[model samples]
Target chain A: MNESLFPAPAVALAQADVPVWEAVRFTAEGLVPAIAQQHDTGEVLMMAWMTRETLAETLTTGQACYWSRSRGKPWRKGETSGQRQRVLDVRLDCDGDTLLLLVDQDGAACHTGRRTCFYRAADASGTLATLTEPLVDPEVLYGPGGGHP
Target chain B: MNESLFPAPAVALAQADVPVWEAVRFTAEGLVPAIAQQHDTGEVLMMAWMTRETLAETLTTGQACYWSRSRGKPWRKGETSGQRQRVLDVRLDCDGDTLLLLVDQDGAACHTGRRTCFYRAADASGTLATLTEPLVDPEVLYGPGGGHP
Candidate 1:
């Protein structure tokens, strides 16, 4: 993880401003879809779900924290593979349901070791093609099973 | 709208390929979040929901179509405002629950007349700030109440 880019953790909310967490509209499952995008380049990296606790942690720590549906726990981005995303800004849509995270990504965002999880695209012919190649070996990131569920 | 950029409507899906819509995991509400990103720039413009029919329509028509929860109907992006999104490609996450639409967006993507619906960012101090100004007047697009529900 890029330590220098990390924002001060657990900073106090401004006294005059409303709490950020209040505006979020979590699903029935207490989860919200969070999309991570490169803060400067605007390249969307990956999307995952966030529970209230994880979202609060992400806001306080200024790092990406997700609620892993399969693992059934909090999964810190790059906690295992070092592809940490330093939070630059957090946004909620007008309806207050979805989240948009502008982050400074340290490395490849995909467990497949690609810069982005969305590296495949479907053409008009309905054929799926790889839009981007893996930047690092999967073995180097998650070891075996390629992080598959 | 860029007519030439539109892929042929209802182009044949390759026989060998599995139809993408089958893999999607809609929520209990029968909705899946579909994110629209600028194909070339990688800028995420908006996040909306899609039903199976809307998803199919988007694929066959090569345009962005969504399920408007408020209106309870299929909403063809730019159908009313002339801010259509021409689909360049489509993608599903590994779990096939969420959708990513890579498209060429025409005009503002937000009903508020902003390029993106997510125009507010919350800082560590809990202050909310406008990140982008509206590209056009909402009155010019949606008129009157500006589509606010």
Candidate 2:
């Protein structure tokens, strides 16, 4: 990956003077796990992979950007669907392998049009149950393709 | 990995009749990302990697178990640090590449003694700041060695 496309490392330094991307432990595919949470509600919206380029774009734009492993490209949140995640804060885990995004989410975060990706819960009987209903029709969000863009 | 140690696939099925671990997309190292969130507060406590064995252990034991990539072993929560995370619910992402753990966390979830692992946030100016303070001293939790057991 070309590091030149990203902002200067010094400009995006995190805590302890460590460069944000420098501290991340990306996988062999150059992807890191990022979790988006509702800043006020503490509700976890979704989890996605972010490449160095997407991470940089997120930092610069104050918007959530993720790496689409299948598409092999950067995906700006709400680019195809109107479910944008406006970043309120960005955090890296103590180990720096994971990321936390406190965001002001608009509309559904899941492709299924659910408010959050985690709509299922396992009960004491070890049976999984859907905990929520889709807030919007998924077809409306993804169009006739019925898949991510 | 030994599949025999895990419960029968029929007995550990999740929603849609999918076996709990069958649909998981483990990395080349046989590891998957797991996020621990507070069951009541919905606050994300920590993120870790879990191997098939650890994931099975967590399901059967109803506790959080993770694989320590550095130590190359399964580490049960609160084994040495007294920071146990009791599993309340477990969910898989639509892509089946990530796991969400709703847990009743005991004590601090962070090695730094913070309630959550993500205690720092970066602002629009790209400046990092601490969002929370340590709930306990690191020395008290890890003993004087200041390293994982």
Candidate 3:
């Protein structure tokens, strides 16, 4: 096992030696953040986190598989809503700390039935403004928008 | 005056002490990268670089601005196309090294007259796939899409 450099726990000294998964995984705080973008239009869809296992699923299946930090388990984008994001390219920056995923988004990426979750904007004064009108109704997208009240 | 960190012969660092640009600004090869996302859709439209002056303009004008490395000058997003991206929020990550600019993007964000710039995806097998189809014809968008061969 190789020694870690910075102030953090060493996950595996063999991480560099043997490649168990196709993706190069690194956990910043037990979770690796991923930035997902629309493959064709360069539109950033959303940002999520994934574990080594989830990353492997994306690489192997050509479909996005994320480990929901909130749910604490695996997640298939659009699995329930039919808005799955098909994997096109998985890229890592020079640092190998973050991931840039190119995907073919089947439908809206947001539970609100919009194309993405970031439908609001925050101004310098911290005022939140609605950015775009919904493309699809939330009632039609998610079973009551993920069953939220 | 505090000693300047970046080697910018073009920039004058006289007011170095009074709330000047961040130290990370100087370390960014004199050009900081900016991420643009569609405000309503939360789709990441594109990524471009910015100089300090342009960054200042964007904040002051409430518009999307970028530093064109090719032209070696400033560019206002959608200025010529009328597809301008109105700035909603500008954020610096925890490290303050990178920037995220959320904007209300009007019309298309790409010169090809497409809603976004990422139009293709490459898989693990190096196979490229088309993700999004163009909304507007490129001829009018680019003054011509590669022109009649």
Per-residue C-alpha lDDT of model 3 across residues B71-96, encoded as one tens digit per residue: 77788877666778887666543233
List the lowest-lDDT window of 10 residues for candidate 3 chain A.
A4-13
Q: Per-model C-alpha lDDT, please?
A: 0.77, 0.76, 0.59
Question: How far out, in Å, is residue A46 in model 3?
Answer: 10
Ranking by TM-score: 2, 1, 3
Which docking category, incorrect, acceptable, medium or high, applies to candidate 2? Answer: acceptable
For candidate 3, what is the DockQ?
A: 0.05
TM-score of chain A of each: 0.85, 0.87, 0.77
| iRMS, all models | 6.4, 7.4, 15.4
What lDDT score goes with residue A46 in model 2?
A: 85
Score residue B73 of candidate 2 by CA lDDT.
89
Residues B8-88 of candidate 2: C-alpha lDDT, one tens digit per residue = 133432355656566678988899889998866667788998998888889889989999988888888888888899886
User: What's the CA error at residue A136 for candidate 2, in Å?
Assistant: 1.7
> Lowest summed lDDT over 10 consecutive residues: which window, candidate 3 chain B?
B1-10
Give lDDT for model 1.
0.77
Candidate 2 residue spans exceeding 4 A from truth: A1-15, A123-126, B1-15
- Backbone clash pairs for candidate 1 read A14-B125
- Model 3 TM-score is 0.48
